[model samples]
Structures are given as C-alpha cells and as structure tokens.
Target: MEQAELTALLTAQGLRMVDEIGPLATTGEVAAAVSRLRGAGHSPDLVAAVVGQAHLRTRAAAKFGPFADRMLFTRAGLEQATRLEIAARHAARFRDAGLTRVADLGCGIGGDALGFAGIGLDVVAVDADETTAALAAYNLAPFGEAATVRHGLAEDVDLAGVDAVWLDPARRTAGHSETSRTRPEDWSPSLDWVFDLAARMPVGVKLGPGLDRGLIPDDVEAQWISVDGSTIELVLWSGALRRDGVRRSALVVRTGAAHEITAASDADDEPVRELGAFVHEPEGAVIRARLIGDVARELQAGMLGEGIAYLTSDAALTSPFVQSFRVREAMPLKVPTINAALRWNGIGTLEIKKRGVDVDPAQFRRKLTLKGDASATLILTRVGEGKAAQRLALLVDRV
Candidate 1:
C-alpha cells in the first residue's frame, strides 16, 4: 500500500468504518459496500482504503484468527506474515531457551514480533520498507515500550543486548499472491550475511521448505514444519536455540494436535521392496527434512522405489507422520488399464495421486469415463529400474 492510503486506512474513522462494514467476500459485494459508504458521505479514498483492508482482514483471519481485525497489513505483508500459531511456537523456542529479548529482523507487519511480545520478551522489530515498519509499529503499539519497530536494512540492525535474533530475510521480490522462488544469493541480507550473524549469536532463520539441502549449515538444527498437509517453512536454529542432539526435524500439525520427529543425522533409507498391502505417503515436512527413512523404520516399511518418497509395508500401520492407505489392486500404468480396473471395481469418483511422474492428475482424471457408485484413490508411480522400470497404478483406500 502507498503511504497516503496507509495513513488513511489506519485512521480512527477508517478503522471504525471497516469494522462496521465487516468482510466483503466478492467484487459485487465490495462494489455495493462502496456505493453505500459513498452515499453515507465517506470520501472516495477513505472508502477504498477501508474496504481493501476489510477484505484483507477477512483473508487474514485464516492465519491470524481474531487478531487480523485489529492488525494492519500490506498485500505482501499479510502473505509473508507467519501464522500466529506458528509464531507462538517460534516464541516458545526463545522463551524456553531463557532468552528475554529478541531482534526480529525483516519483521514484516510484525507477525513474529507480536508473538515475542505476547510471551513477555522485549522485541526490536525491523523492516526495510518504511510503510511496513509503520504498520508494524501500529500493530505492536499495544505492547507499549516492550515492542519497537524500526525501518532499516536487516544487516544494519544493531543487535547489542539482544539475547536472540530472528531473521526472515526477504526471499521474494513480488507480492504474496505471486510466486516467490528466488535464489539464496538473492535473499535480502543474503544467506552469507545471515549465516555469519548466526555464528556469533543464538539465531533462528526462517526459510522456504524447498530450500536446497546443500546450503544448510552443519552446526545448526534445521526443522521443517507443515501445517495441516502443506509444508510451510524451514527453520534453522543456532546456539542455545538449537535443541540438543537434534540436527533435522519434521513437525506435522493437524487439526488440534502436532507431532515432531527428529533425527541427529540423516536417517538411513529402508531398502526398496515389492508393493505391499499398505502404502504410506509421508507428510511433506518429513520429505523436505529428508527424514522419511526414519518414518519408514517406525512403520516397518520399505521405499516404494529407490529415490521415491512413497513407502510400502505389509502391516497395517497408522502414524501422524504419514497418511496410510490400503492397497486394493495394482496394475500397469495405462489409461485403458486404469479405466478397466476402475470399471471392474465399480469405481466412479477417483482421487488421483502421482509421484515421480509427469502426468497431470486433473487432466488425466478427465480422460477416464468413470461409472458406478464407488470412490477410491488411484496412485500413479514408477517402480523398478532401467529397462525393468515400469509405471504402476495402485488402487487404494484410506486406512
């Protein structure tokens, strides 16, 4: 958002009007709301700013819950902002480590800073963007002197007396709605500078889950976290923030519960074996952390194929780390063969799942003329090696 709009949106009158209007879900609804506000003698700029914020808050509710209403956000800030629940977890790491003060470098919209202040830690939240820093200062105003927002480069932030440093380097040049896959070297403050800082202090760096494993430092504890089924972020912990004997970890969060599996070293992979009665799809966090082998050992399962993430075991097992499915039928991967198998089983609706293959599930599912009342998951994956390699379709049911 531009400076003037931001100023207008954060005004007492704008906030009151936004709260009164509530959330506008559709373009038509927004237009209607705008007309009503305009008729009520609200200025055009005020209506536009408040309406936009109201819409963003509605969307932000998924990440911030009720706090979204009180919070101010930029389009990019809301997108990059850490979910409040996840931020609380980050705060706990520092609080448990006996750290009372933290430097939140690149603290967009003060999402993590709010968590730090909420846990009674003194926070110095820094953002490179002036407007974002202003919004952060406004959002964190409730904490009074305990939380402070600064507008500056992360690398230039003074860290004196800060017990811990939290760095979320800007990884994308575009807004949150756009793809933000940038090279490590392109990261603001750069991974080089961030690592150098980590070496000198207790540090926590948040990165994309898909970051190249080779770039990870050996001394830090790397944790991959997935909220629901989506792999969210990879957190690198250094010094006292790093858990004892934990080098790599996968934290899976579902509905109300969370499960974490940690390994001191990369877990050894179980040997590839023939297709079994049950197939387990390891959570995305586990796969990203390269700890799927540990999960396989826990389930007494073997890799579906070398270098493939899918696991198979004859025993029926259920774990929070993997989504287990029961294999009903296996067939050569072909449209005709899959259709025939589905027809034979009276399967009408199919949940197409694919790995280590190029086929688009949605496009491929459209080709099959399904009939009957049954529903089942169809897994497409390659098995075997070299000339013996062949794609197989596994009809499976949730265990």
Candidate 2:
C-alpha cells in the first residue's frame, strides 16, 4: 500500500498519524489497529489478513459475544499460518530424532516456529515478507526467547548446520489462493533447491495433499497428513527417507488426540493377510504410497475387481487405514439391478463408492432417486465389462 493510504487506514483504526512516523508502523498497537481497518483500496496481503481477521472475529464474537474485543490476534490469523496438524507432525518427527535446534525456512506467520517452540525446541524462523516477518516476531515474543524471526529468503539464511531444516515453500505466488496449484518449478526454494538443502541437513518440505505422487523424488520420503478427517498437506523428507523407508504416512490431529499410520518398511516382513468378507479402503496417502496391497494383506482381504481401490471379504475387519463396513446385500452386475437394489434397501443417503468406475457420483445419485432414513455406502463397480455389481457397505465408527 502507498504511504498516504496506509496512514489513512491507521488513522481510521484509531492510530494517530505522527508527522515523523513512517507509513508502516512497527508498534504492536498500531499493527493490531491496522488489522481491524476497513477501506476501499487494499493490497492482496492486507485483504487476506483482514479476511483472516474477520474469520477470527466471527469465532471470537460467537464465543465471547460482546466480549470478543478481549480476543487478540494469534499468529495463526496471519497469512503464513500452516495447518496445526502439519506443524505438529513435523515437530513430533523432528523431536523424536533428538533434533533440539531447527531452522524454519519460509517461516510465514511463524506457525511452524511456534510448533517448534511448543515442543520445547529452539527455532530460527525466516520469512521473505518484511510485514509477515515483523508480525512473526511480535507473535513469537511470548515464547520468552525460544523463537527467533528473520526476514530473508531460504537460500540466504545461515543454516549453521542445525539438526533439521523445515521448508514450506510458497506453493502459490504471494497473491494466489491456497487452492491455486503451482508447479514445483514455480516454488521459491525449488524442489532442486530443497534436495540440495537435504544434502546438507535433513530437510522437510510441505506440499499439497493432492500433489501428483510421481513427482515426489525417490530420495524424499513423502507423507500425507490430515486433521479432523480432512487431508491437509503432504510432507517430503530428504536424507531421512533413504534411511527410514517410512515413505508415506497418514496423520490425524484433533484436540487431545492424535493418530498416525505409517507406511510399512522393508524390515516389516509381516505377511499380507488373506482377503476377508468385507474390505476397507484406506485414506488418500495410503493409496498413493501403494500400501493398499499391504493393507489388504494385513486385513486378509482380496481386491474386489482388477485394479480397483477396494478390498473385499465376507467378514468385518478393523483398520485405521480405511473405514470398515459390513456387506448388507449384493446385487447382480447390471446398472438397473444395482439401482433396484439401492431402492429396496430404503437408502435415501446414498454414499457412492467406486474404485474403477467412470460414472459420476452426482449423476448416479440423481438418477437413482435415493430416498429414506437408512444411510448406507454403496459400491457401484465393475465385475466385468458387460457385468456390473453393487454392494451395500455398513459404515463403522472410527476407533
């Protein structure tokens, strides 16, 4: 934002425009005021931060009602906040390896740095944006000397040979939305750069969960993490992957609870279990890691059809990788027959599960005219080209 416009926003937020004061104020009070200012013109960062403030305000206003004024800005409200689950897993993994000191490259909003401090690790957090870096310092002040924030690029930062280097490259450009996908080449600390960093110290790179699995370098162990049942981000570890073989993992985080399912390594020689009566489908991370075969073997289940992402058996099995369901009924390998079976089951809430089918769920659900209080998961899949089959699945509660 321009100097005059910034001054006007500061004034609107109750900050006096001092003759000697600069356009961007570093004082905490002025910064906090800028967070609440509303106006016509705004930079993308300002707009994004303000929207984050609104989201925070909504939650604060709901809980405190009129007393929300007491609610202050948390580092999470800042633009660089990483999802809590992603940060926690990194902290846990790093700490378990006895790495007490860490450098958080691209430490936007100091979220990962905060996670490091929360786990009692020392952190040197760096960000390219001056405003974000300043705010990160402000937010990290409460850590009482545990966290350090700097403004710079990853390549320029002094590594000093720390235990691990945590890098969350800017997947999108400064003004882009979180959903906006960017190729690895577009990233600031490019994939090649990250690999270079790994050559020096163990490096962890945060990626989108939807990232193409093939693009992940063989030397980097990829991990897919989720929070509250939604997959959030993928993490890639170089230097460590070759030694650990823990290539892929699914992590679930919730208040007072945490669940992690790691990929089976070469040393984990447990034989694959036989196909069971019912099959369980694993999370995206599990499937991407090609661990489905291992899961099927673990549950003693067989693939339903050729190349399907589903397991089949007659008995119920409990596994964290995927939801377990009992087979209520089976129908002939025909669309009409499957549609008829759905109606007979009195299922109104039809959750279509297809491994290899090309039919769209929305169209199939609309065509079926599903109706009732009964909730069931239906698998509309191929038994063969001319033949099709439908199986009603019984949803099991997560353990």
Candidate 3:
C-alpha cells in the first residue's frame, strides 16, 4: 500500500466503508466497488486502498478466518503473516515457559503480537516498514494497553523490561505489493546477531521450513510445523523456551486438533522391502524433521525403495503421521499398458502422485482418454536398487 492510499484509508469514513463492504471476493465485485466509490466523489487513492484490502481480506480468510473481516493487509505482508491458530501455538510456548513480556521484532501487521496479547502477555511489536508498522498498530489496537507497536529497525528496538524475544527476520526485499526472497546473508538484523542474542536470552525465531539444518544452533530445539498437511515453518527455540531432550520435533495440526512427534534427533531409517499391501506417504512435517523412522516403527513398515521416503507394510492400518494407500495393483510404467488397465477398471478420475519420476502429471493425464466413472490414485515412482531400478505405476485407494 502506498502512503497516499494508506493515508486515505485511515479516516473514519474509510474504515466504516471497508467494514460495510466487507470482502470483494471476485474481480467483478472489486470493479463494481471501485466504480461506485469513485463515482461517490471518493478519491482514487481511497478507492484503491479499500478495494485492495477487501480482496486481500477475502484471500486472508483462509489463514485468519472471521478475524480477517476486521484486519488490513498488504499483499507481501499478508503472504508472510503466520496463521492465527499457528500464532496462538507460538504464544502458548512463551506462556508455557512462564514468560510475560515479549518483544516481537519484525512483527508484520501484528499477527504474532495479537497472539501474544490475546494470551494476556505484554507485547512490544516493531517493524521497519512505516506503512506496515502503522497497519500493525491499527490491527493491534483492539488489545489496547496490552499491545504496543513501534516503527523501527529490529536491532534498534529497546528490550528493557521484556522477558523474552520473538524474532521474524525479514527474508525478502523491501516492498508492499511484491518482493523477492533475500539470501541468508541479506536477512535483516542478520542470523549471526540473532543467534548471538538468543544464546544470552530466551528467544524464539520463526524461519522458513527449508532452512539448512547445518546452520541450526546445537543447543536450540528445532521444530517443523505443518497445518492441514502443508509444511509451514521451522521454529528454533532457545533458553528456557526450548523443550528438554527434544532436539527435533514435528507438529501436525489438522482441523483443531494437534498431534506431535518429537525425538532427541533424527531416528534411523528402516531398510527397504518388497511392495506390501499398503503404502504410506509421510506428512511433510515428518519428512522435514526426518522422523519417518519413528512413524515407520509404529506402523511396522519399511521403506518402499532405498533412499525413498515412502513406507510400505502389510499391517492394513496407518498412523496420523502418514496418508495410507491400499495397493490395488502394480503395472508397468508405460502409458498404453496403464491406459488399458485404467479403462478396464472403468477409472475416469485419477489422482497422480509421483516421487522419483520426470513425468509431468498434467501432461501425462492429457495422454490418457479418461472415459469411465471410477476414480483411483496413480503412484509413479522408481522401485528397487541400481540395475533393477524401474519406474512402476501403482494403482491404489486412499485408506
């Protein structure tokens, strides 16, 4: 959002208008809003700001739910903001650790700050971008004295009286609408400085899930979290906030329930075996945290192929950490052979999942003339070792 647009949206009329209009979920609704607002003698800047925020709020509903109706967002800021439920879990860590005051550095639009304050903790939310900070202050206004937002660099923010720190370093270049990812060296406040402070005080750092494991500090607890099967973030916990004897953790939050699997370190991988009655795909968080071995043991399963993450077993049962598929039949990877089988089975709806192949599922789907009423999942993956390795297409049903 530009300064002029932001300025226009800060007025009494603008806020009321946005609240009344709610989310413009479609392009036609947005166009109608823009035309109507502009026709009513409203300035172009106000119309743009209102329309942009309305659309953004519609998109943000997936993350914030109904709370999105009252929030304001910039495209890039909303993209980086943590989900409200995820933020609450982060807040629970601080609360569970007996921390009361927190300094939220790089607080984008006060998402985490709201979480902190919602849990009755005092929060000092700071952001480098003036527009974002202003929006953060606005978003956090509901909390009144519990939340205090400041516009300043994270390194420059005073930490006096704060019990702990919450760091979300800016990982992208400066922008309101569009930004590109920055290298680790280019991160705001720098990881080196952040890690140094974390060593001296209690701190929780939110990072991208794909962060290099080698760079993680030895004393900190590294946790990967997945929401509805999508791996979302990796959080490094230090000092009193770090869970004891849990160096690596995978948290899976589905619906409103949360399940966790924690280990002191990555467990050993199970050996490869022949195809079994069922194949399980480890959840993204479990894969990222490298704790598939733990789940495999629980299900009495083994790797489907060497170095592959797929687990196979004849147990006819599965765990929450994996999506179990009952094997229907295994066929050659050739398109024609598979098409004949699919047609014979009357398969029309296909769900393609691949692990070690170069085939584009969309393009591959186009090659087959799907004309029946049945549905099945196709697993295109390489099985067996070295010279025996072959791309096998397995037809299966979700268990």
TM-scores of all predicted structures = 0.96, 0.73, 0.98
**Of the candidates shown, which would achieve the greatest TM-score relative to the real structure?**
3
- Better structure of 1 and 2 per TM-score: 1
Look at candidate 3 and give me any clashing residue pairs.
none
Tens digits of lDDT, candidate 2, 262-303: 664421222223333465666666665556666666676766
Order the candidates by TM-score, highest first — what do you get?
Answer: 3, 1, 2
Ten-residue stretch with the least lDDT total in model 2: 14-23
| lDDT per model vs. reference | 0.90, 0.61, 0.92
Location of the lowest summed lDDT over 10 successive residues in candidate 1: 174-183
lDDT of 1 at 88: 91
